[model samples]
Target: MAGPLQRVLMRSAASAMHRAKASEWHYGPGFDPQKAAAQYEALTMLVLASGAEIEWLTDADDGLADSVFTHDPSLMTDHGAIILAMGKALRRAEPGLHEAAYRRMEVPILGRIEHPGQVEGGDCVWVDSRTLAVGRGVRT
Candidate 1:
């Protein structure tokens, strides 16, 4: 049997898809805003269907096109959550937004990475209870 997902974070793609230019992200072709919205709704429904309580980040409609991928801004552990710093300049605001949401949800924040150090949550993978492998590259 699959383990229960206690909580999950998600962002709506409506504003991001409708307001931002596709050229900003080099989305060259086949980018449909309507389709994107449909897919996003389907994906959110799937997450809910899996028995996870979702925390939708509704206030993050600041035209950050990549905001829908919430996993990149924070890392969750049994002890608490770590708000990460984005390596990409355009994505910098994401961490702060995530921090506010986590605070509202009463999720403990362990710490945050400051300037000169960069890590995206997507770049870190848990190997076991105590080990985490962090990727070192442009994004992390």
Candidate 2:
């Protein structure tokens, strides 16, 4: 059975979420900023939500040592790998690190995309063997 306090908490949480608008709620239930993050961190909600894993600006490895434009491989093949040069300065070093790793593995270089056209790693997705899409996510 649901307790009275649990019912009240549900109502309060619902009200807070409703008032903030569906897409506009960065803060969580209680409508308080300080504790808002805590409600959002609850396990029940996160498990049900769609996760977007972005290693970008990874606190540990920002991929700076690699290159400013590094991205995941197009395809991880047994023979070797393909390194892509990103269009943006924000990712200039990532590809180089990937290149070094491939070098250690004794893989061959497949060629890269040069400047003028900018691409963000966030905008990349592997569609299939014949297709790889690169979208400029933060394009102005």
Candidate 3:
């Protein structure tokens, strides 16, 4: 989570976010798909301007509303990515998408958190080069 930005894996908002059912996804009433897609585009442009290589995951509408939040599906370490298991039932399919992306990019996978063991990338923090602090909470 530190150092220079080299590559980032992201999914396009138009793929799933734009077609997400706000209510089912627990999105607030004010959630607007069009605005979300526009914002995502703007953010993508900014990331591009920063000169970081962007690795896109997919453009297909997989009905994974929060799939755009790519940080939670996997953990990237110096060795490789650790595919995580989602705590949310609706998000169970997300990790596979990330694993596929890694395979496509030829990125090695160090490990995976299988069923009955849940670990979300968002719930982890790097303490140093070799230490990782993982928080246990509702979203973890």
Candidate 4:
């Protein structure tokens, strides 16, 4: 059997789609809020089905449209979470919001990536307990 999931972090599509056009990550012609909401609901159901305790972030009016992809702001590890400093200038506000949520949940914070070092959580992958592979690219 699969090991039990400890926790998961997710932001609502309602918050994300409200300002989709302003998002730097979306290149599509236009965003349909209804479709986004449906997709988000489906994804949440899947996470719940996997038996992970989900933490939903409802504060969406921060003008961070890309917030729905929570994987970009922080990376979780066995030791703790590393709050990333996103390479995208528009996304700089994300990590602080995630940090507050983590603090509320009592999740330990290992450290944070400072200004000079730009690291998006989406660019880093944990190969194993002692190995982490990070991509060095425009968005990393």
Each model's lDDT comes to 0.83, 0.40, 0.90, 0.82
lDDT of 4 by residue, 9-113 (tens): 998988776666734665475667778879889999999998889997766577777788898999888867899998888789989888999899898999998
Ten residues in sequence with the least summed lDDT for candidate 3: 14-23
Candidate 4 wrong stretches, greater than 4 Å: 1-4, 22-25
Which candidate, 2 or 3, has the higher lDDT?
3
- The whole-model C-alpha lDDT of candidate 1 against the native structure comes to 0.83
The predicted structure with the larger lDDT, 1 or 4, is 1
Candidate of highest TM-score: 3
lDDT, model 2: 0.40
lDDT of 3: 0.90
Clashes in predicted model 2: 12
| Stretches of candidate 1 exceeding 4 Å from the true structure | 1-3
lDDT of 3 by residue, 1-140 (tens): 66677899998887678778888999989899999989999999998998999999888777898999999999999989999999999999999999999999999999999889898988998888788999989867
TM-score of each: 0.90, 0.39, 0.95, 0.89
lDDT of 1 at 11: 83
